[model samples]
Target: MPIAFSANLGFLFTEYALPDAVRAASRAGFKAVELHWPYATPAADLRAALNETGLPVLGLNTVRGDLDKGEFGLAALPGRETAARAAIDEAIAYARAIGAQNVHVMAGRAEGETAERTFADNLAYACTAADAHGIGILIEPLNARDVPGYFLTDIAHAARIIDRVGAPNLRIMADCYHMQIVGGDLLTRLTHHLPKIGHIQFAAVPDRTEPDHGEIDFSWLLKALADAGYDRPFGAEYKPCGRTEDGLGWLKAF
Candidate 1:
């Protein structure tokens, strides 16, 4: 399976609007693009942008509590159960119109209690709801350095939760940057857990910049994905080093 790039509109349009981001991604030769939060922008506008650009949406996260107030995660275990459910429901409805099959559910930070058990329970609940919508739910782990005290900071732990949830619709959304920050052998882990992976997002390790700026050899990683039978679009979820278009010079070779 040859790898196809999917731009994350969140990064490209961080300084611009969704419409311009879609156009930029299409111009960069990306076949698909994803957003961070659909509710922040109107669904009609997003739909129109996708229509104009002919780019499919790969995935999006469920709505978080507050984007500005530092609340940016969905599955926060037992304490935030009510808010998490509401957000997941909202994201499912959004996905219906945006044509997305997977939604990243952020795991809440552990509160120094029985964190693991609470996380497992929440994951099961989320997976059940996602299965009802005929969509998959992805558990994305942030690095401990960036998100201190976060309960699901380890992909291996996330994998365990998915196994405990025991639902085919629940899986891990493997972000390469976080994986590297957490000090894991990505190739080995990705190969070992390929069956439980729902989607893939990428950023250059160290700088969190475009692939060309980082030391990560994405070509080899992509080839590994191909050999491992991953036939989905690889999400280009990197921060632009400069102008978004200036960072696309390497895609032709990819």
Candidate 2:
């Protein structure tokens, strides 16, 4: 089958509320949808929206508290084990409620051995909580340029954490936008890390716009992913230059 596409509701459908975004994505031809955070709207409402539209929610992120306050993620912060686990549990419950297949565990601003240990412990807890439901736990590497002081900014480091946790349900949420910014060897990294990847996302490099207008050619990248046997949906997680629907020519072409 041809590769599927998932709309990133958080970024694309900003004009509408979460439930409306779900319907919009489905109407626009996305096979699935992913959310950055869908907590503001009740889970039942979101689930109803999904059911109404026949669109599956592929994944969602663990709560990233107060971005304006410089708080991004919580999984790796030292001395915050209780809070991290709480956040993870909350995400797992929400994922279960909405039938989401994966949850991206965000690692906050932290460093050194302490951060590593905390991150691993938190992930193990998350994996254990999500395993019974068959939900995958994902860890993503944020680009330092866009998110300064993010604990997990290197894909290799993320792989190490996944190995250390040793949880079958734990995997990487490889966002091509961040990967291209922090580590430019896209194809090689994607090929090498295929075993650990749970989900894939993309946006234009440098500008965070539509995938087709990037320095990185998504057509080539998507073809490469197909060649490498990646059957999962590729997420469109970019800020549109105009109306979200107006900038979907690439999706139409694909």
Candidate 3:
């Protein structure tokens, strides 16, 4: 069977408005679309775009707290519980309006026991809020190189946190590009965490571009995912090397 794919609007169509990006992804033959922080766009506009394109939204990220200060996320930041929970609330509300399936709760730069406790607490709060709306909560383990000092940098750590929280709706957002850089044991991790995986995404390793130029053998990787029983559409979360639509040969190649 052919694998279905979801376009990541943040990376794929930066030149276009968020709503227009939705239409562009549909035109490119994507089964669905995801987003980064899309708070600037009115939820109604985006929902109309999705309705027009007939594409369901996969997920979107919580806002990166104070980007000017280099805060990528707030969940793991020890002293920002209020901001973290508020961000979670906002993401949950926005996601609900757009009919998204998941929310990626980012764990910002931090460490030590305090950070761990804060992250778990925030995730618990997020999961509880999302569960009511029938939306899932996702935590992605960003790599050290690209996301230096990030709290959730290892899958094992993320899984442990999920287990600690013990929320049925909580799961991992496995982005293969980050995982490959973190470590090369993708298949083993995927199998081990299959029960906990909320979503899957891919891009070129070393350089976050279209999968066609990557070190990863996406054809093999995709087959492995399918063989492992993950039937949901995989997320195409990669920066384009050129015009987003022009760089879509890999969609057919895959």
Number of the top TM-score candidate: 3
lDDT of 1 by residue, 125-240 (tens): 77787788787888888898878767777788778788777888888888888998896688888878889887788888888887765657887887788788777888888888
Q: Alpha carbon lDDT of residue 74, candidate 1?
A: 47
Candidate 1 residue 82 C-alpha distance from true site, Å: 0.7
Residue 141 Cα positional deviation in candidate 2, in Å, after optimal superposition = 0.4
In order of appearance, the predictions have TM-scores of: 0.91, 0.97, 0.98
**Which number leads on lDDT?**
3
Report the C-alpha lDDT of model 3 over 1-254, residue by residue, as the tens digit. 88999999989988999999999899999999999999999999999999999999989999999989999999999889999999999999999999999999999999999999999999999999999999999999999999888999888888999999999999999999999999878888887888999899999987899898768998888889889999999999998989999999999988
User: What C-alpha lDDT values do all the predictions have?
Assistant: 0.78, 0.90, 0.93
**Model 2 residue 170 distance off true place after TM-score fit, in angstroms:** 0.3
Clashes of each: 1, 0, 0
User: What order do candidates take by lDDT, descending?
Assistant: 3, 2, 1
Report clash pairs, candidate 1.
76-108
Model 1 stretches astray by more than 4 angstroms: 66-70, 111-113
What is the number of residue pairs that collide in model 2?
0
For 112-168, candidate 2 gives per-residue lDDT tens digits of 999899889889989998998999999999999999999998889889888899999
